[model samples]
Target chain A: MNAPTSIKEFFESGYRQFLPHVSIDCAIFGFHDNQLKVLLLKMKNVEGWCLPGGFIQWAEPANEAAQRILQERTGISQVFLQQYYTFGEPERNKEPNLKDLIDSLNIEPAEDNWLFRRTISIGYYALVEFSKVTPTVDLLSDECCWWDMHELPKLLFDHDLMIGQALQTLRMQLNFHPVGYNLLPEKFTMPELQKLYETILDRPLDRRNFQKKMLSLRILERMDERKSVGPHKSPYYYRFDKNKYDQALQAGILLGF
Target chain B: MNAPTSIKEFFESGYRQFLPHVSIDCAIFGFHDNQLKVLLLKMKNVEGWCLPGGFIQWAEPANEAAQRILQERTGISQVFLQQYYTFGEPERNKEPNLKDLIDSLNIEPAEDNWLFRRTISIGYYALVEFSKVTPTVDLLSDECCWWDMHELPKLLFDHDLMIGQALQTLRMQLNFHPVGYNLLPEKFTMPELQKLYETILDRPLDRRNFQKKMLSLRILERMDERKSVGPHKSPYYYRFDKNKYDQALQAGILLGF
Candidate 1:
């Protein structure tokens, strides 16, 4: 479906059903091929992109609304999603391209339409394995895909600010929580996990020291299986021991930044 | 001054100006006498108490609303404030004692009163020195004072939940930020700072190890002068080096839990 159809349906069917002046946006970060990616929705007719977001139903909780949006767009479930921040600056609705976004959709919004009002958006983010999700476009966008974090297109409204805050929160969360395990495959080499951490942190870490610090936390269990990549020496596959990882998280796993 | 007058004025003069469906609550933490305390307001003519909070204006940013609420209640300014979480559960406004709270004020709310709506509150917290603030009662309460963290009165609505989340955030923030400096008086003994941390973390730490860790951060300057207590050996007074503290904060000072 394209912009005109989506806008037509929104005015006829979905506009009034949304909770006024409040929405939820999810910054679903995915990891694959040693690169960090974020799930974004490409606006059908407009040359813009935004995080997969949806309005809160008046009867539903904000968190439940976020979960529903993520499930509807990406088909990922049972992941721990955290609410990082609320973006409610009044000027956010006055984005320069907002008129273009509306015009491209080929619909004139009524004065009473909730889209014209300022919105208070709650941001929720999670780290997920890229292979787990089958991205599907919802009524609001034509295409949904994972884009590299560094090469993101300019987003609608204050979504760029939302992504920046999510990344900062994830970096701080990395120091106290073992988050890399879920973003990687079930059995992955040490280099893969280290590379994931380095990407999220946006810094280079000493290989030997990183391994030593990670091992001392006692959360990762080295598997007997080994993976041979090309002509390089084989590396043992390691997985997180769930119980120990939880315990370490509660005890404050301080990673060297 | 009291609930009757506050409520009378709220109905007579202040009921319609609040931004519908959104508010800001501050868990203003204060440190004194080596104990952590939170600023709470006692509900006049009712048995419940709650944190200092206020509603956002329609044209105001949430952060500005929080700062206004904090300043209006505590008479303090220019302190570091952090927005930690937004509580948007639908059932939060369905508390059983809400009627009692309204009834205690002896004013009948209009059918369209904003107070009857479900509000999503953004929680912001800051650590401040107790002596700096001269707490004042707002139009909704009779008394304002610092309540010990270990012993808190039953709070109204989901304020208790907000305070709990704020404390958890503060504990995590303390791990990487030099927050003790603002909460303590200038030129304090090492033990005083340690006690403040212990109180906030709700756990004890080794005296020598805590001192070593704090000193190594290089944000505190040891003074030649010392204070004597009767026959006890004088403990050296130390003050925070503001420039060094900012540098260490920028560099991410990691304190052990």
Candidate 2:
């Protein structure tokens, strides 16, 4: 099926090309300046912000649909994306007066249009390099950008709940999965690595204990100290040992932090 | 919408009362005789077994629908069920010459029947007490029973993949979640508990190390020794400390296996 060319076509016949009641939403997370942020979008006629989401096409797998939607909005491909949950409360997409809202936008859909029907969304969460992302708006959205995890706006629909659950899943995954591959630079200091963990976990960690635990995981390789500063001021830089990191990820190592 | 009365009505007008492209499948795991088992169903005229699954009603929440389906098949309610993944490949549900197969059933559905359309199924895995369950068949299935995890039959559709992913998720959850609250009897020995863990992990663990780790978690409490066995052969009984287990679940403790 071909893509709809206009809003009228999208509302009238989108069900022909896309699965009617199933959609996909992505919680794209990035680490910048020691702050964890999530990407959000403002729809063309909607009131508040929400995650970058789109409908699944008729012949597409759900995972491929999620990847396509992420690439369309962020201009990034091959991201670290994982499906975390499916939100299917009956009234999750219900607005207070949806018909009146659609009328105000000058679109007249049939009483039984697919757009007004209940939808079940598959939720995916992604980790990407912050500096490399170029957030772009889709046809239905007017603006797209990042929002601090701690200072998020009142999101539309059940998006706030989606973000919360996604964050919780990501935090739980840190215990087994080797993170920072997509969120950090090629070379980073030990303190920088600890800060990333501390930020996502939303807690403080002892310096010595954190270093000992991380080093014992055997996923990091320490580089030689920079000679630019004095001996006492110079701190060692470290990068992830990619081979060991992948092996640990496959074997499911436990990081007891 | 009211439930359909017969197979004819279900094929003709079930879409009026149910969501068209969304369904739920459950991988119900039970422990019996030191073996991990999953519940499977054989459809009335189908060739192979599949997970116990059903459609979602128009107004029902997905989670409530899963609980209802589980109760219908197992005669057990309030089982520990969790949503793990959503399967939505375009051909995941496709069967070769399905039209001819439907004709053999002596029921004629329209060319655009909802049942023939692409469906996205929400995958939920449940943990239930094995002894209390009474497996029962549904309208579409001929039999329902427990199949040993290692000896499963060639399943229908993508169900084999679903079971594999669900088991992986369950194994990963063991690192943080306190299991055995529903799988074990009230009083059990250390060997019994260790056996449960070993069965799920698919590997034998060092008995001393397993005991030490479980004890350190502080979610188990020792009980008085049973008087039936000889004094030297007697092993003290133990049960989950409910309060501690719940607390650890909330705090997300790391069990480094």
Candidate 3:
């Protein structure tokens, strides 16, 4: 027999009883086609929708586990995954289907009952461009998609709360940090950037005033060419200058809220 | 022999096994007398100081647990306690004495081992007026005091990190929301407000420019009386108007970073 010496064994010795009880749910946000979207997955065995989530192993840091989940579900690495909120409502996951799955796992009946009774979840939000990735479903889910936020279908458990929290956190984050660069693609137009903010805040923003206000922040670097979208004066494309963006961040200029 | 139902009952079921293992720590922030102060507690068994923390019963929301902790440990209730960070470094609580306390409670030996090895903590920050609060020790602490931000004694676990994150968050929050009103008394002089910002930001702001900038926001209802705090020229006192404050929040005034 091998000695339980590594981090996996080291944590298992202490936290084995709580194995697979806590999980990380991610509201993976993406901006594409001038609309804001979130990555979602359908339940593997049931007709329910959920934010991308995975069980936290005993040895993993919550954040590292979230990042690992991102990699396992989508072939992307080092994206901006922020821990936004933690869901701790009692009896959050006591559904009959979920309980049936626990029984199938052959976990101690009493212990599983206890663990399943009050599952607290740590919520995270990630930003990535929709066109730059492929979805890879883990063993837990059947399919994945970048569902438009306004057109979202019904979600399971407290996922609706998670999404609402993510939106709130995004607006709050924007109050201090410019995100379109990290959240959007490299050569996005001004309208595309503005739409992302408007969608998140769930309100209409005056185009002229919004552009003037954002431009004055001096975080964006205007590119030499315009996006060839349509007949209506295609706006100049812009990319966030790291130098300018960092300076603005230092000045607390993220608010387009 | 009683059924553990609802949230209150849910907490009663596993409170014994969960109480001593999971702790919620708070970064209690108070700005008063023109200096930024944080609440720190003297460790029960050790000479070192630490942030105010207490164990979470299984049934409590992390926020509810934080509120209970803030109230029990500091006798303050319904203050502005907000979750800011979570520290989950595997070796976070590696104290042997702590491990013994956990084991003595009749939890799994592995639970104590896991707690010492995998003790994860959620950090919440509360906003308050320091002059109003008097710290009192609970079962886990011996003494408590409001420690100045500039001069701090050695602390336990990842408390310093929690403080740094709180301060960083506070500074950022100030850029979006006016904070001195809640942190100070109902009516305060402009200079007092200025000094509070300066002390926390650690930057000297121009008096003439700062006054003009603050008055423009229209959040303050300038009062007729002047406070004679110093032997120098007394400044006019201003009280925050709630209507103007809410209006300003809705308008999203550009508070220059």
Best-matching candidate per TM-score: 2
Task: Candidate 1: give the clashing pairs.
Answer: none
Query: Which rank order by TM-score, best down to worst?
Result: 2, 1, 3
Instruction: Write candidate 2's Cα lDDT for A1-257 as tens digits.
Output: 66787777888889888889999999999999999999999876667888999899999999999999999888999977999999999999886435545765688888779987899999999989899899998766778999999999879889999999999999888887778887888888888899999999999999999899889889999998542356577678899999998888788777777
Judge candidate 3 at residue B183 and give its lDDT.
75
What TM-score would candidate 1 get against the native? 0.91
Tens digits of per-residue lDDT for model 1 on A19-116? Answer: 66677899999988778899999876666788988877666788888888888888988786889999879878666545666777787877656676
Query: Top model by lDDT, which number?
Result: 2
What does the i-RMS of model 3 come to? 2.8
Clashes of each: 0, 0, 1
Task: Answer with 1 or 3, whichever has the higher DockQ.
Answer: 1
Supply the TM-score for candidate 3: 0.82
Model 3 chain B weakest lDDT span, ten residues long? B1-10
Candidate 3, B16-77: lDDT as tens digits: 44533346789998876677889998765575788988656656666788897788766768
All candidates: DockQ: 0.63, 0.88, 0.31
